[model samples]
Target: MFQNLAPAAVDPILSVAEAFRADPRPHKLDLGVGVYRDANGNTPVMTAVRYAEQQLAQTQTSKSYVGLGGNMRFSRVVTQLILGNAEPTGWFTMQTPGASGGLRLLADLIAASRPNATVWISDPSYVNHAPIMRAAGLRVASYPYLDVASGGLRREAFFEAVAGLGQDDVLLLHGCCHNPSGVDLEIDDWQQLASMVSQQGFLPFVDLAYQGFGDGLEQDAAGLRLLADASEEMLVVYSCSKHFGLYRERTGAALVKSAGSKQVQGKLFELARRSYTMPPDHGAEVVAMIIESAELTALWHSELYAMRQRVQSTRHQLADALSTNGMEAEYLCHHKGMFSMLPLSEASIARLRDDAAIYIVAGGRINLAGLAPNKIDTLAEAIVRLAA
Candidate 1:
């Protein structure tokens, strides 16, 4: 059995991370993985998370299983955080290992419910989206997304593809900050999508991994809520890895909105049971403690705000540096969250790594948060030289 197995394909993102780790260059830059890093080049745990853990360690008594749905309190608070004051009558939420887990769970749900449904994603979406959906036996396809040269959405092609979707389709959208490209859909785009989804009957599936990293928490969730308001049936996957800084803990949830909430809830539990059975509770409990307490919640909000500002500041610094180096990169400032695709060719990307010791993932995506402030000029210079 082992001898018959084929060699595994290297992961595009993780392989870049591994190569960066193996390189001995002291001034090497890593813009491959999507994790957030501070100006000091650290992914520091938030103060609120620290306090919550301390409280849990002292007061909590049990390490018992959190069941198939994990912590209900965490699900409720996070749902409220995502939906705001929107009516919650048709929603059913359950904890998963992370947004990745939530994605798979919902993919399985879609496969179970509508076996022939075609799950349509952006042309260049999160690297794992298509594979996960396909693994769950759902057909995967792409719609036109980014115009690489301009670093903007391909608005006409996008709406054209969306216009064709119907009842047998599932439109998977990034809730706020789009991964890899960082070009998000504006509110008007979401509004238009809501109208089309309502009229065309395609189910809206949103993956919200970097909620607070784009805009404010509420602001980032606006499009998702708008779509939710318009569609009677929807699917959502939420992650605490970014905003709550719970990356290693794998805390997140899968949410479904349908008139048949009871049936959806049962199906989610059944799917979860055959998979992980229960999501890890430590991170969810920490999140619950923070959200439930006023003081901790405020502290978390402030810390998240500072992180968002830092990413935005880095974006501006990089753009300015690129301009000074005789390259126009104003689009860097316009892209949201931690990532933006530089319009670099494959040869340019390879030259960036081999000649400049800069590690960017394939497709020219750079993590703005991963770059230290002092290295912005270095990156800008490398990019300018390579492009020239």
Candidate 2:
């Protein structure tokens, strides 16, 4: 009976967890997933979230369903965070299960808007990106990013990709904390993108998942805000999972900024009517409770800052160790996210998996959060041996 179905390939990013589960190596480090793990190797609950949970737990009123687009209050809060407070900008807000859900929905929406719209993605982009857009019936093309030579944004190459694109094409840009590959465009680069995006008339789509994890909450949002300020119309996918530490509750919003308020409201309604209407209440409530409460907001910011500092420190430590081990690559300091691209070959990746039980993706996009203080030496040794 089961023979009718063919073997299914696992999701590349998530498949790492499955492999880790089967491995018996006690010292093995799991750097595959894009989750935020603390120094102790656990993704701890934010202090604000804990407080919100306690408060909500004590006085929760109803478990009723929220019609398309979860809660109104939550959407407003999301709009404020992603779009910032002031604007004559037109926008729509739809809450999805998570950012993944929002991304899929946005792809579908874009496809529906203009069929076969070519989405320009970074060559070595987040693994799931191409799949989502391709599944939506849109074409995916790569622009050269992460020039392995310098391990930074290939700015000239990126502009070339944009230059060849049609006005209807969609350019998917990471607002902050680029996933898998952590190379972020500099402010001047973003300004150029904004001007180009405006001039070329190609649609802009922003994947903003890690807001507070990179530089700071507002600092990370700089690019997104810049794009929003420039574009007459744009799409932004929001994820509160990392920012609020609500991974499982599935809280995220799909935002579209238009030229006018009426257009924004209409698009929001239509988008809501077409897809999963409302975002989840639990996560939204938690975020709202935290943000609205001054004390909780402060606590959340502190936690976020601490987490940011830890990642930056770990990144420095990694680059230092790599240099000490006699390697001269310098992308570590420039990368601004939880992940980093290491200089590794296919044979080396395979060998590391087999011999050292050191797991990383084929492209070597490692989650910096997975490197604990103690495991750093082990990882450094593994890298040095394999690199040698």
Candidate 3:
């Protein structure tokens, strides 16, 4: 049975990471991985999470299994954090390993419920999205998003692609801090998209990985709330990985919102019961404790603001560098979030890696979180040489 096994292609983003790791130069920069880094080029654990962990280690009670839905505390904490006080009835929720695990599990749930459905994703979305959706045996399609020409969302092309979406189709949207391309839909744009959801009848599936990494937590969740308000049914896969700096802890939850009768919710609950049976505990529990404590919650928000401010400052630095060198300003500083696609051609990507000892993805998605103030000039020099 194992004789026919084939080697698989490495993940595009991970491949770049591997290359960066193998590089021997000390000056080599890694704008590859989506993980956040401080000015000193380290992924630091947030203060609140550390305090929570210290408390947990000293007085934690049980190590027993957390149920099929993990901690109900996760549902409560995450719902309040991600969706505010809104109650979503007829919804089935389950905690999973992380956003990646949640995505895989959600796709599985979708497949079991509607096997033949086609899930739509942005053209250059999070690298893992398409493969996960397709691996679950769901057909995948792309809607226009980032424009290579302008280095931003192709607004016209986007609305056109969603123009004729089928009623039962699934559309994946990054709730905030859109990966790869930082371009986000404005509030009015979200209203239009919500209208499309209402008219077309497709489910709006949200991938909310970087909630506090964009604007403030509440401001970042605006689009999500807007959609939930417009949506009779929606699916949200929430991740605490980035926000809590709990990357290795694998903390996340899958929430399905529906407006159906009690009978339908019961069926959804049973479906979750059969999937992973239970979810991890430590990460979610820590998150719950932090959120529940007023002081910890404030500290968490403060830490989140620090990270957000740093990424935004990096954006301005890069944009100023670009403008200084006589390049267009249409896409750089104006964009929001942890990532920015520099409209670089595949060859430019190769050149940066080969010539400057600098590296980014072939599609040119750089994580603003991975950069520091000191390195901006070096990166800017490289970009100007290549693009200008």
For 131-207, candidate 1 gives per-residue lDDT tens digits of: 89999999999999999889899999999999999999999999988998999999999999999988999999999
Model 3: runs farther than 4 Å from truth?
260-276
lDDT of 2 by residue, 1-388 (tens): 7888988767877787788889999877888887888889999888889999999999998988886767667778778777677743467777788888888888877876688688988878888889889988899988888877678878887888877766778889888888767888878888887888778898889999988878887888888788788888888888898878899999988887765656555555566566666667899888878878889989988988898899989998888888888776567887887888887887887778888888888788889977787787678878888856
- Model 1, runs deviating above 4 Å: none
| Residue 297 in model 1: lDDT | 95
Candidate 1 positional error at 278, Å: 0.5
Give one digit per residue, the lDDT tens place, for model 3 in 232-344: 88889999889899999899998878765454445545655675566779899999999999999999989999898999988988888877877765576767778888877
**Each model's total of backbone clashes:** 0, 6, 0
Model 2 lDDT vs. the true structure? Answer: 0.82
Please tell me which model should have the higher lDDT, number 1 or number 3.
1
- The full ranking of all candidates by lDDT, starting with the best, is 1, 3, 2
Candidate 1 vs candidate 3: which has greater TM-score? 1
Model 2 clash pairs are 68-277, 68-278, 69-277, 69-278, 70-278, 70-279
> How many Å off is the CA of 27 in candidate 1?
1.2
Ranking by TM-score: 1, 3, 2
- Which number leads on TM-score? 1
